[model samples]
Target chain A: MPPEPDNIPDAGQAEEIAELVAKTPDTLPLKRPATPVFVPATLPDEPVEAPENGAALENPPVERPISVPQAESVPSQAVSVVAPVAPEPVSPPAVEFSPPPHQTFRASLTLELRCATPDASIRYALGAADVGEDGTLYDPAAKILLTQSTGIAARAWVNGESGPLALAHFEISQPQWEKKEPLDQSDATPHEISDQRALEGPWKLAAASVRGKLHAHRGGWREDAFAHDLAPAADGTYAIVVVSDGAGSAPLSRVGSNLLCRETLAHLRDALTQSAPLSTDAQELRERDLPLLRVVLVEAARHALQKLNEEAAKRARPLSDFASTLLILVRREWNGQQLCAALQAGDGAIALWNDDNTLTLLGMADHGENSGETRFITTVGMEAELPSRVRFSIRPNLHAVAAMTDGVADDYFPEATRLNQLFGAVLPLVENGDAPGAALLRWIQYEKKGSSDDRALTLCWRDDAAPQPETVTEETSDGHA
Target chain B: MTSQLISWKVRDLMTFPFLSQLGITFALSAAAMSDIPPPETAATEVAAPENSSSDGGAPELDASMRRLPVYLVLDCSGSMTGEPIEAVRQGMKTLLSELKSDPQALETVWMSVITFDSGANQVMPLTELLMVKEPSFEARGTTALGAALRLLLDQINQEVRKTTSTQKGDWKPLIFLMTDGEPTDQWEDAADAVKAARVGNFIACAAGSQANEATLKRMTDVVVRLNDLQPDALKQFFKWVSASVATTSMNIAKSDAPVGLPALPPEIVIVP
Candidate 1:
């Protein structure tokens, strides 16, 4: 007589197979092709209710167990059925069953699990699997097949750390099984990736400026100013950039700032013409010609001040009404080396980007007795000491240099720390083919915490410079006057 | 006789509150709010929003909104018993009313009121201008200017967040100190402490002929003298204070550099 179909131990057989699959190590050979299991279509469509004893069964089923070798050789679609009889004295009388070979019902299921975080790793009873970079995980025939009444437990490690264990109960009435939605859906995207190639290359100069929100809100004019003149040498070896900011207190500071930019560029042009012969030797330029550069910086300020005074006089306004600040950067090619000199007055800052992607703040803002207060180029004592304020240095692998007014300075150097991290987000885009000035203008305008000042920024870089190894060097300077 | 005289002056000033109100109304109407383009909207032209983030990796726009902390340090001493005290109350009401009407001031200015007599008390903690209520004043004891300064210093340390390595802090505070007599307590030490803190701009106003101008000058470089305590003169002084505060609030929002204050009213002379 054939065994009764109701006595088939489907749950007990599945539990044993699940235990065997859980014990298999990840290093086990994959030579055993994935097996697709088939079970009777009459299995319960919902999770089986726990037995009355509340304890899980541990005894083997009445049917014999399949050996590991035999199990590996089983066809993917083959199904094994075992019936375990309860050893009770009052067992119900078994009903005779007639087996119909041609009418046997069978079904197969394929399960796929996905993690919400793309980087998540999932571990199941049948072993562990990692989600692809695209955040998907699929098992052709989950080594231990799951029937309609089977329960699955999985633990996920998001970003390499384990999270809470997840328990899911399966219910399927068809041959193929799938959940309504993905198991996990991540909301976060990967860190921003830029198409570096799209950015224009071999940039020589970038500049941008914007009116502050406060200024806009109050209907005040943009008093801050910035200007840059990048004059690449005929030999493609040197350049000169000049930037300036007008005083916020001065009624005609915008004009003053514009004049300063023009005058400084003219002065620099004259100095470059005068020192054309000394540019050939790097040592001579650094040692003997450094004084000349300093004098040039002072003369530039004086000329700018004289022009501003003329304008103020024309308007019958006090020269103080046109007060402003100035910054000048000169890069000279000497014997295959780059020498840089910087001059600044009033409130603003300068930064140098090295080949290694590190930024060095050259000079801090010239703050006055208070935080918002600062000395102006046209102030009573500043013109006299302009030359001494010039800072000089010899940078071997300099990639770029940036200058900004107090509006930008307040955001970048709100405190004493020199190189704010916010600027790091900007450095990569300087060389990007996009208009560096326009990019910088947007960056400077980013709403800052306490500052709402007219912002101005100018950047100069060499695209041909080779990238340097990562070596962070902090160069401190007495930024306060 | 002195007490009788004080009572009469107080009654005279209280009878006409419209005068101060009219002055503030005229000042606010004459001034215009600025109309410059905002920086953030302009920034989008260069870099896409997705590519930009603050120093932190989080994709958040930098916020430009900030609070301008203002402190009104008043002298509620015996010298200000009558008309002077009454004028102060009217001045405060007018100031608060005008500021509340100004959208810019309402958005940025945070105010606190500190009154000093035998002791100093913070009648109002730092609060938004729109939310502030005019404080009641009663003049009775000696002027304890030193104690007032000490109290101010403590309040500043507790109230203001100085800029830190990783965080932005409140703007430098604007302090207005109005007094009518010499300090009855030791105030130099407190003044020194205030100077050392260097956290805000302190403008001292010496009211009446008997006010100690020299002491006021020592406390702050920006000092003004009120020639008399007449209601009109006091009203003019308050008008100037309101204009100064309005201009300062507008200036910081518009410019990065420190701006010189608006000219003081003719009746209130700057102490050179």
Candidate 2:
């Protein structure tokens, strides 16, 4: 058969070849033993017997004994039996075969032949053999020829002492080379997060938020909000970043979320300016300055609530209509160490990415028994709930810290392992060419399962040297509240 | 918003030929099953719903769409043996056929059927609408309304998934109870249980003259009474049900608010 285009090996091609070879017959009827067989050069003086069906024998008429070498040098055990029949036409009909389930097939043919003379080299040529060395004509020593073509007859010429003998009657049926895909071992395990981002130094603050697809489809406004301020403290060392998320059910929650962000940063700034500088030691800060931080958070919450109530009264609505969650992160460099303090309410997460490629959850989202239900900053007794929700930490090797609303939490903090892997993937992007917040916003919006919620994220990091503030802020306002 | 709502209603009224073009067969299973606890002298028969015979046998499920589970708790007492029972069957078929044509309804609705006679039995388990079959009903024995409510509560416990801290579960279930007569068996205890379950929505429907509207009112805030058992009236009620389901699916897909049920058909009187 003519050679067709060689197929590129797939995952299952090796298995198919093994199976085919196992199914192939080891010996054909024409294959002789390795022992040498001599043919007398001289024939009897009687009239040479003509083969049946008007075919004449092509044997040499020399009258001497000839020693035929053993067939031990043949690469294959199959012997080529030259028949004196006319070559069949090489139409090379296209054959289509369906493979079994989970299996793929390629067209091929297996040729078996035997040559009789010592120098009886069998040269087989397949039609259209342009598919490289593997698809071209077989060498003279090749007794078994395999080609990737079907339904075309192969022409084989045996060169011997008697001269070239053409045997072109050999026809091959298309072989269905079956291959099965390799079994995947990772099917039963949870997906492993891939972290390919390259981290560098000199990071800046970036924040972005997008309205959810479902909300946009319903013509609803983007209720989620966030704000980050990196003003230098009086001591010229600390910076503050505040983030918030508004309740989707509340019509005025967006106002509340934005107000809380500004008010929280303002309150923190006032408290830091009024108070005197304390010890730079981590233990001293935890023991002495922690209570002061708590007071700052409570005071900020009170001011934010007062502002929300004034707005609600101005509009003749209830305060509950402006429910929102808050997250406050304070960072300062003390004694060559990076320290962070955070306070959070409701379903959003804060993660700290350290220089050693480890992620620590500074604050996990506050979730209720029911999914999508969580505590809000506007709860009746948020002041009392503040102590448990506030978090403080100090890390000399900190790279970056991020705070995100529940929309991003669905993808980054669905579980502990995913949280770590996600932070690892994003921390490097903090120093990437794309603005960190824009990169994160793209990552968050990349069609994830159960992520159709308003997303707001704030990323904060300190550069090795003071550089121009690389601040990126993105917001989407559909104009309907 | 008004135009969108009107468009959806108009689409609901217009029937499409795609219903017949769909290759899925609506083969009802005669066997009854219950995921609920059995009452004394259980007469319920449990078997798999016809569509669940093989995973490959039914149409593919769209995993992206959240399921809006609907339970139809029907009363098959002796009072509804003739015309009433026929109307119920026709109404159910009409509901299925209309919902099959609405792409949103097909994507989000999951339905199950429970019938109470001497005792309650789940004739069909909670199944996706794409594979749902029109349930068969036969009026017989007494109206064991209490037992049916108990079965429904139990089924809700087993079938409906509640949200947890880490994973999101199935949406809250919507239940509709249609009965033609007052309960012959004790039902007050079961009514309290249903109320305590805090199901997303419970619409009690009293069909025909013999049904007790007062008793149904106690079971749910939304109560509609069908004064007469007629095919056309029942068809309107079923159309209303289909519209309500479609609206709820659309609402939940967009917002987290409680499902807003559409107004009842004019033929059915709403009990204040």
Candidate 3:
């Protein structure tokens, strides 16, 4: 005899399956491919009541008479009556699903389950590895709605026997994204200025500034700026590399960073040529070049800050709106020694890598107690702090020197401890056969787990001309007043 | 001395049956009621809601990525019984739709809901965005905000992962708290504890005229005030919340700016 059908949902295929199974009372359900029966559009059907144990329901299991397509079986002239019998104490009942086991993850998905055995209690778990005692009882009246990717495991128990686990896995494919170009409402900065350049000089230079993944995700352009040029004076060739990272919160910081790097390099070149230097005695370098170089680097940084102020004034914006961190490095082989003068305001680092895998931090990264608290060059009175942040080093046999924004510094942060590993990562870029500039650009684009800020990296090292002749003569003996 | 004289006069007039029913005695009683300030401490400390049948925390999610834990602490007191409660239901629907459409939020954001009314309870635990079900809330009882704050502190400590030398932890949790009236429980201690924990970024909303903005100030520096209890204002609040959560989810893994929230609608004003 067929099981009692009073509690089965009156809507959808479940009701039709019950009557069809009643016709063949001796056979099991789900094994037979019972054709689906569709309800007429005109029936203002009475809704079934919810199960007594309401708290167990994760979803409202009540079935509403909704319209849908697909009529496979002959439209029944009227509802078929089913002869009822006491629920047979059968072993675990076999369960089947309407939609196949695999499904796609969306905002939400509705799933319907069918059981052929009589009086079987179906319980299910979602997103769980397996169903156990913690699974929710599946009330037949409700449909299972899945909102995210998950594994659904269901089982049915009849009398004392438990059925085998019925499992389904739904996966969400990568979403198709629409191409979006940033709107250039402001004339201050272009939407995209990501670029790379290779410079040939005493110092092999490779420089790149690229937008980060987070910015690209939201249609934002790169906010880092870098300018590297081999400044030539009468005495020697000086490789000046400047890198600036714009504040993410500042809308026009791209302009700020770009202007700072350009103006600082320009001013430093002019100041280096005019400052009666490079001709001073090498033994008295600290007394002569140190004091004069400090003024030159600080003045260049001040000039950059001044340009930002002028730009902010022209735009009728606050100076703070153009906040960025600036790092400047000037390297020259003067009198048989690699002489370097560097100044940093705000966060980021200027480091020199030695041949033995040791890295020396030329200028320190200014950081507060929290990771987010970073200094910017536009901070008021920042020029006053420049003299102290400036570092002068006259070392022998420098392997490589790198100037970077916080974007690169953050990957190896707690600056005190991570510089050695940073050079380890940076050391291999030049040997990649192509222009080291292009290689550096590709290197910065490499993905790190938590590093998604706009990156600006400028690496300068001695190429095949490492032992090149030091062509400097003591001439033009005028000294700065 | 003046209040004492008035009390004595009220007592003396109460002896006369005809005058006892007049405004003098009623006014005296009203004055006495007003004189007793709202209690700062509960006689018995309110306990965090235990994991009841429905008050279970987030179910196990099949995720290997770092989660962005977000908590919504709402006030469901007796005053929010009618239109206000219904508006909140609609707001949740709006918030869910907003978050689900946001690809970043849908990918990483995990959410939980805590409701305070006479006592605070976690209606839903930290569940993934896909598995998050909009909690059904009922309006009744006084605002036991202290219980809610303490419960939130406990829940965050229990659920949020911390980064160590070996593994990266979950991003700092984001909390959005909304209340429409003065708290009816001792909340100062809990507020102080929350302020000192530095465990999460908080956005406290003093959501109606009766809401104590001063009380919320102690809980967080980022406080927004709603001038009225209108449904439109509350709906805008929820929309702003959706935008903030979406923005945070995109930046949570990479950027290092202090939890930058999106701009609020005109209906809400920043509490300076």
Candidate 4:
């Protein structure tokens, strides 16, 4: 006799499979090739009642007519009608019967499980770009108009050691207007661009050391290991480190990131070392030259991505398949004092770790809350449109800083909270004997794992150990969970 | 009894609420109360937002906004032989360049030039810096520095009046009386005019070796010893002037109101 039909509510595919197995009885003589296994026609027409344990089941079924397929075999259909056995245990019952010796038994099992996997990570190394040497990075993709008048180059690493990439050349074009009288503005120069003023004393120029790493996105485990140290000059000069990440989606992001770090260092050094008196004030410098530092850096990154794309395209690849972000750290020590500055653009975060367990954000992270989206500087153009770039400043009084891409930062933390976490993780290192950059890297890999995109960091520190001032005692809720 | 009553009246003025509203300090009230008077200490101790008292101390303007009165006295005289004439022309260019380096110089300095060859001629009238174009420097005959000096005194008076006309703050005017040779005309009257005005106002100085030291002695004792006629010295002098002007201007800018008198270098002598 055939076994009695057991009731099974429809859930999702998992539930349907479970129900089908439970409904099948072991009393009937099993058929050889065509066994009577129930093929669920659409999900059951009834709402799936919650399981006894209250675990979520399949979606509630919408009201609809149930259409069950009739059995092909008359014998099987008759057996079901003829057989009337006690209902199977409501809890779980297992029934097994040996298949006919002459018939071969075939079976298949299917189960479903849901798990969130980490994303792909892109680590950066270093790269550089020469303005006007190649095509001008003035197009929207480059987001800057660089000219020969303002000669500047930038370098940085994208993800880990893949780069020391070269960005496109960036420059500031000369003004159409010229001054006839020493400072008199000629009609050619139509308007004053910005307030002309120089930064005053109490504002310091110095260097700091920062360290950090990037967490891997699943299998693409990359490491961002870099270091920066600042030494004081008797002449009150400085050495700095500035890094820019290429769009992770770019083909040569690693190269771009590294290139940016090196080029920025080299350019700033060359510019300052030429013994050119820093236009004693900010106003003097602005008038004598263009405030193209920010734009130049962006353009350089874009250019690097472009060249890498071109090279990759020759090999049949999409540009920006591995682009990264950008960061800058500058240090100068003078008169027994240190002055430093750090800037970041894209998904990276910069933190200052102090001796008294204080942390500050040197760069900001982009949160999708404002517009439900986050944007980054990228090498690739969508329909020929480039992404935006950002700039920030830091100075001598800076204790220590860390710059890193999102890959190492926990996405669970809101932008503000993540920044706090970044500061928290790196602050102790700067305070401790640990090198700022190195400590930050370790924290990103070990402390902040299973996070977001690619990561990169750079740090600068003072050589002399002047006592740090007392830290502010105000408690802040700005830390990461 | 009368003096005591006067003191009480002065105290009332000091305590009056109206002074504070106008951003003014009542010195009488504070002076009466304090046993010791504060010396003119480096201007650093003075409150930044408030103006320093003019008694015994030069008006303390915010260092960033001080204006300068620069009287460009040119020697359109016979002794301005070929090289000196060319040097003077080139010197103006250098001054422009040096001044431009300092952003504050543009706003702080009011430039005027007096040419004295056969007679004193006002080549350029005192004008607000933001409005006037650079004046052309011309050269010609005999040195009539005395006449030029007279004109300078009159112009200084007019400028002081114009500055006070607005009830705005004032800065000491600087007269850079330059000459290539001795005065060919009688200068006693002009010298007396400068000396009289010099009592509590204006910095009158002579600029060349050919300048009559005796004649200048009658005008204020301030004399710029330009021992070197080289173009470089001229450049250095102008640079110093520019820096001084800028320093004062910066101080002036720090306050809401301008200072009444800018501090001057005690009779600056441009050494070779």
Candidate 5:
């Protein structure tokens, strides 16, 4: 193999070589032995008969002895093999025997990935290479140094007793950009704080609810409630909506509630990406799948909470100011089944109205005596700590699943009989009607008159024949007390 | 904002792929079987025999060992924008403060930071850590790990090799190479140079949440996986680096000639 384009040393090759050498701490003694470099001129003519192949002896034999002069340039032993000098050498045979100008050495490197368990851990075939032989992996080229190609070939196998069922092959190459620049001495010139708050409708402050009866008063901050519905997609995939109620005690609850919904959406997307597909077999046991899905949801919640903590820490604000209750609903269309999983940690309600008119309360808050009855699962010491368990799972072909903050549950689930009646009326509206979200808003408006809090509800229903809901919806104008 | 959220979602999806990539397999140790070096023990200075074979006839670049040479080969390409770049900047400030806290760094620890944008730039040269102020960096451009590596290797060979005539010191040098993206430029030449210079003199590590570990593994075979591009983690990494260098420099200051330097933590997984 001939030398590749990169291997051909040009005019500045030596300078480049010298710079490579200079990057090191020259204090450490370079143990380059004083042995003379040797380049083999050619093999001596022992007159050995050529084999039948004729391929081995294609080149004429000529030999050059190793002398002190030849050894000085290339001191390394790997490149120092030289043929013994031939005695009374006649004119060297035409350069037929000179070794090819350059021989490219290729080493087949394998990176195998073995998955110990399909759901657990995975290991790389080539764990870590000590290409530099030094304890520290200080060189960026170390990856290239170990593998033959500047690109390292890696293989991954999953579910081999270790973890997960997975296999993959990929190459790792060095960065094409330059190194990082040192920090500027100047103090960070503070920039304008990005107004990242997400809001619905016109008011910077507003409440979303199913009930529309409440109206605004003279000087109070509270006002009428509006219902905003997010329907299912064209592919029978309903959007999972979650409404988090900000703690009224903290001024930032409104902000935290909005952040919770936004962050939960982000987390749900992330979990879905990382989550393996749930086939029909898993869907059969949606009840059993709740535990695992719970862990995922709780983790997502914890992450969002941590982000809030970080924001507070950055601004030197107390953590409590950024606290809010999280209610999350996840729905997907998979394997000809619409799998809906709703999780409520702390104070929230998750209700499912089956197609058969039976209402199952998937989640409910601990409504105690305090005016703010239901409590968020936030403990004094456990900031961002994951809950012991999460409660959620897939529901196959349900009429609809609704998750609402405590404010709605308080006004809506006033009595067990009323709760059953409410489901009886609402499930049919969702099951029989063309527009379930509009129907839900009408029902909630009749049920509650005056409710002032960060109220929200997300209803997701899936049916092959259900009409596709538009992406955006018009906000309703029902006042709440 | 929605686009940002969508992109982040995509990034979240890549975590599995990224985790799979990190499942690297290679020999645990090449030279000898050793236990994980204890934190306290690794922090302590080890002395090599004054006339040990490895230390014999080692050329001293400077008459005085006070000048410490540190070459930072950083990734400042377009890929390392946003938090990654800002974290690096904050990390450098923390490193400077850490050095300032150490008396040895004040006397020694000459620093040079090299940034490879389209190509390698000597953003900062061999200035005394105490004297030189940190420079500003706005990361943007393609990654040229190869060119950057070659540039650092060359600078080390040229500038650090030319030592001062005042004191004969044989301090260990350090090189921290970090990037969050793959090499878009040709890297064969730099890889060859690194292979040639691996004589156990430098400590190189690559870091970044989005770094191409396989590429890093090839370059130095040693990769420290940073869980995030948080400023604190960077500070921790640099602190350890600075401590290791300062400790080694202290040893060199007390020695008459080259001595066996302390080893880095073995838990630091090396790329084979």
Candidate 6:
């Protein structure tokens, strides 16, 4: 076949010439004549052809020779045959496409024209070569569809001078998906997190969890969990909302997060039953309920920690293998006041979008010294700090309360301020939807660079106009709880 | 914010029809594999949708837009002349191309090229994969591996942002060092400093038969040796490096251990 790009030197000819030059000295009378003594060695063209396909290769490990297993009977002869000049490299590609052409997608390609020049306008023509500033003014929203193999050349037009012409060729082929399997089959978690919604009185509960794009790409587990139940409170029904983020490095963190959410709510329900009911009056409850609410929250958190340890012990896995972060809240509505008690460990946030129209981070977000570092529920002394971690609040005109794993929490990072942005976006999903759980799942997957982690969010709010409620909601109650 | 969220959702739901006419066609890339994929059709979600941005630039380029800084510290010594140097160039071309195609890497990966010859210099600054001007390479003088390490250290410290109360930091940096021979300069203390600082997730590559493995071990726990010095090995090596970048960028709030990278291609072997 003809070389498509004439500029590329023919590698086959180069290698042959290199072999001839290196062998000239070996053929002389002074050199050791050992290579012809061992008859079965094929030297000229085998190593060149051995790695015919990438699939045929697997790493034999470091500090070791290539496991090609050259004939050992006459090892020195093997070296002397082609020993002088080692295997040379194949020639470089004719033209180095700036970012090499990597993929051939089955479906059409979605192309985004980018100009790093801060305020440059990008213009492009689909079928042309180098469409400087003459194609069409680029719109960020109007998607550019490439349904066939096309050359897209775009340039940033700024200050009457064009930036380096950005050119790329996209190839379209039949649908192909690269699949990555979980390393351990027995430790596999669910592929998709199901939507769960519940309603009581004017109060509504919507909980959702979705595997992040990266995790989905890698066949990684949806390590986040969201669960809510209208467990019996002291005087009224309390909406117990919980969300946990499992450690990505942990082998069984998906199981751990799910277990922690269920146990914590269960333990909290039983613990709260024997407590004194504080006055439903908003002013009185704030003064009286603080001490009692803190204790019950810690007790529930401690029990959940113990459950993780027990589950870890049962599976014969390290405690760290079942590590996860926890965010749990128990809130009740009585008279006109809405009182909430939140317990958090690790980095996720428990925030209340209060009636006063301000976002309040109910508990502290604990990130250790590093960027990706955070304390897990299974961390030593986690329970010791549980009491101080609880935050109790009484909001008379409460709008909504949300509990989210760091997957969702970190997207709206520096959660102190950006949560209002998250809350503003989520309010529409809750108020104007029949399946808020499903909406929440889809809504949390908003495109953000470098923010790919399994997102789990639970939102509960009171809708005074939704003409009360019957007890006819699908109760996600397991008989054990 | 709501509009941004809705646009992404809308794109996810959109489907396309294949065009009958191929426009502006070119010959298959030299790196392109010849084998056709088996027609195994499964409703698998696109593994890399997260990499592409339907929107032009990341909004405000704020905290959530955490950068995955990738440093390529390469040895362009006299020994790396001719075929070896060209292979490095070819490998980088393929690596950068593959990274840009990946949406996540395109969106978040910022790469810097550092080369060492008689002395080390930052050939390219930390720039976004989408906007980076990949520099042309040449093989000139002795291997100054120590100067390369020290320069890499300084660049990382100066470039990588740290997470504070007000601003989010860049993800832990990934450093890939490719060398074809032993260092001619004093490199021991520099290598020790790289290990001691606990700066980046380092993966050193011994590029050819002349490449020294013991010298690389002092700089990093993860070291891989390039086999044969063939173009195929070089291609596979760059492919694995790109995937390693993707793997590190994918990991959010992970453990203390080195991030789990994809398995090495046959042309490379990990030093245990």
DockQ of every candidate structure: 0.03, 0.03, 0.03, 0.01, 0.01, 0.11
Cα displacement (Å) at residue A153, model 3: 4.4
True contacts kept of 4: 0.00
Q: Write the per-residue lDDT of candidate 1 for residues A1-481, one digit (tens) a residue.
A: 2332442436754574455345433433323224322221233223223334412233223232221111111111111111243323221112111111112112212233333333234444322221122221222122223322233444433333343433333333322211122122322111111111111134366667766665555545566655554444354333566666666676677677778888878777765655535544544544456667677777877887888788788889897777778888777654444556777787677776655444445553465422445677887888776755666544456666777776766664432233334345566666554665556655665643345567776666666653432334657677964
Tell how far residue A197 is off in model 2, in angstroms: 18
Best by DockQ: 6
Binned by DockQ into CAPRI classes (incorrect, acceptable, medium, high), candidate 6 is incorrect
- Extract clashing residue pairs from model 3: A61-A141, A61-A142, B57-B125, B58-B125
lDDT of 2 by residue, A166-272 (tens): 22222223221122221433212111111112112244676667776545444455667766555455544456777777776676776787778878778777776
Q: List the residue pairs that clash in candidate 2.
A: A79-A113, A79-A114, A80-A113, A80-A114, B32-B45
Put down candidate 5 lDDT per residue, A1-481, tens digits, no spaces.
2232442345564454344334323322233224311111232223223234433234234332221111111121111111234312321211111111122212111121111111212121222211111212111111111222221112111111111111111222221112222143222211111111111111011123521111111111111111222233333333445566655445454456556666666766556555654534542334343445556667767777777777678868776665566666665654443455555555656665544443445553444321232345343543343343233323333555566665455444332212334444444455555555555555444422113233455555444353443333547678753
Residues A85-162, candidate 3, lDDT per residue (tens digit)? 322334344444534433354454345555554355666566443455445666544455454345555666554345
Worst 10 residues of 2 chain B by lDDT: B1-10
> How displaced is residue A8 in candidate 2, in Å?
56
Give all candidates' CA lDDT scores: 0.56, 0.55, 0.65, 0.38, 0.43, 0.65
Of 5 and 6, the candidate ranking higher by lDDT: 6
Per-residue error at A277 for model 1, in Å? Answer: 4.5
Candidate 5 segments exceeding 4 Å error? A1-239, A282-292, A333-338, A377-386, A393-397, A414-417, A425-443, A447-454, A467-481, B1-272
Candidate 4: residue B9 lDDT (0-100): 27
Q: Weakest 10 consecutive residues, lDDT, candidate 1 chain A?
A: A95-104
Q: Give the higher-lDDT candidate: 3 or 5.
A: 3
* Residues B36-131, model 1: lDDT tens digits: 123233223333212222221112322222467889999999888877787786677567646655545655577889999999999878865544
User: Which of candidates 4 and 6 is the stronger one according to DockQ?
Assistant: 6
Model 6 misplaced regions, further than 4 Å:
A1-201, A279-289, A333-336, A368-370, A466-481, B1-60, B100-104, B184-189, B208-214, B224-236, B250-253, B261-272
lDDT of 3 at A199: 39
Candidate 2 lDDT at B187 equals 95
Candidate 3 stretches greater than 4 Å from native: A1-153, A158-179, A185-202, A277-283, A419-422, A464-481, B1-71, B75-97, B100-142, B150-174, B180-182, B192-201, B206-237, B248-272
Predicted model with the maximum TM-score: 6
- Compared with the real two-chain complex, what DockQ does model 1 have? 0.03
State the lDDT at B237 in candidate 4: 54
